[model samples]
Target: MKLYYHPLSGHSHRARLFLNLIGAQHELVEVDLMAGAHKKPEFLALNPFGQVPVLDDNGTVVTDSNAILVYVAKKLKLTDWLPDDPVASAAVQKWLSVAAGQIAYGPAAARLITVFGAGFKPEEVITRAHAVLAVIEAQLSGGSFMVAASPTVADVALYSYIARAPEGNVDLQAYPNVRAWLARIEALPGFVEFRKTPVGLAA
Candidate 1:
């Protein structure tokens, strides 16, 4: 399997984290987003959206970070990573949605402003980050993991951006539960650190 990704991308890190956790045999192919490599013709052929973190599992191409997580979990028959139970599955999907929506526009977007000079409003995105973090901190108050008693795709989906929220100037210090939760995920076997940016409060 080959993973086309940018090291600093949280979306790329999410997919890469799951692949590592599952002990999947894969090769990393760096896409030079700095050089606009992702926007080139050949790369766009792999994903019309021209994004990093596209997975090529023997020609079975999967794009989008969340979709890639689901695909790899299903392919490996890792029921624990993504349960088949209707309730569990729905719960996981809920957080995955959060990852795509709030997390993306919030912490991830804020980081884009600082790290990549993106045009999003910092105040707006940071507010959104805290709002989403509040919900997650509350949800994790009585549980060790997100959906189930153990780690799920939902956890993987949310982990990267949240862990690196500080890089976006979204402080993690206010939410102790969220901080603890990040620590727990870090202690998990096969866990990989998302490359940190030198900007933001955490830095």
Candidate 2:
């Protein structure tokens, strides 16, 4: 399997993290987003949306970060990462929605502003980040992982951006439970660090 990705992208990191956590053997193909490589004809053939983190599992192609997670977990029959039970599946799906929705516009968008010079309003996205973090804080107060006692795809979906929320100037100090949960995820074997942005540089 080959993962086409950009190092600074949290979405890319999310997919890459899961692969490593599961001990999957894969190759990384870095896409030069700065050089407009993702928009070129060769890359577009893989994903019309022209996005990074496209997974090529031999002949199978998976687009979108969350979709990649689902594809991998189901293909590997990893029920711990993606539950088979209906109610548990729904619970996991709920957080996956949050990862794509609130987490995207909230913390991720705010970080894009600082790291990529994106056009979102700082105050708006930063406020949104805090609001979502508060809910996650409350939810995690009762458990170590989201949706269950063990980690799930939902945890991987939410991990990257929340772990680096401070890069967006969104404070994590207020959410103790959330911080501890982050630590738990970090301590897991086979964990990989999401590349951090330099103090005065944008990747």
Candidate 3:
């Protein structure tokens, strides 16, 4: 398996982190985002969106970070990562949506502004970040993992940007439950980190 990615991208990190967690044999092929390599013809052929973290398993191609997580969990038969129980699976999907929606618009968007000079209002995104964090903190108050007792794809989906929220000046100090959740994920075997940036409050 080959993973086309950029080290600093949280999306890329999510995919890479899961691959490691599952003990999947793979090679990392860094896409030079700095050089606009992702926008080039060759890379676009893999994903027209010109995004990093596209996975190539033999001839099969999987694009989008969340999609890759689903594919890997199913392909590797990691049933625990994605349960068969209807309600449990729906719960997992709910968090995945959070990761893609609120988390994306909030902490992830704020990080983009600082880390990549993306055009977005810091105050707006930071406010959004806290709103999402509040919900997550309450949800995690009595649970170690997001959906089930053990780690799931939902945890993997939300982990990267939330773990790095401080890079966007969104402090994790007030969210004790969320912080504990992050620590729990870090303690898992084969856990990997997203590369840190020297910016924002955490820096």
What's the TM-score of every candidate structure? Answer: 0.98, 0.97, 0.98
Candidate 2: stretches off by over 4 Å: 199-203
Q: Scored by CA lDDT, what does every candidate get?
A: 0.94, 0.94, 0.94
Minimum summed lDDT over a 10-residue window in model 1 is located at 194-203
User: What residue runs in model 3 are displaced by over 4 Å at the alpha carbon?
Assistant: none
lDDT of 1 by residue, 1-203 (tens): 99999999999999999999888999999999999999999999999999989999999999999999999889888999999999999999999999999999999999999899999999999999999999999999989999888999999999999999998999998898888889989999999899988899867
Candidate 3: residue 91 Cα off by (Å): 0.7
Model 1: CA > 4 A from native: none
What TM-score does structure 1 among the candidates reach? 0.98
lDDT of 2 at 169: 88
What would you estimate as the lDDT of candidate 1?
A: 0.94
Tell me the tens digit of each residue's lDDT in model 3 across 1-203. 99999999999999999998888999999999999999999999999999988999998999999999999999988889999899999999999999999999999999999899999999999999999999999999879999889999999999999999999999999999999999999998998888999889877
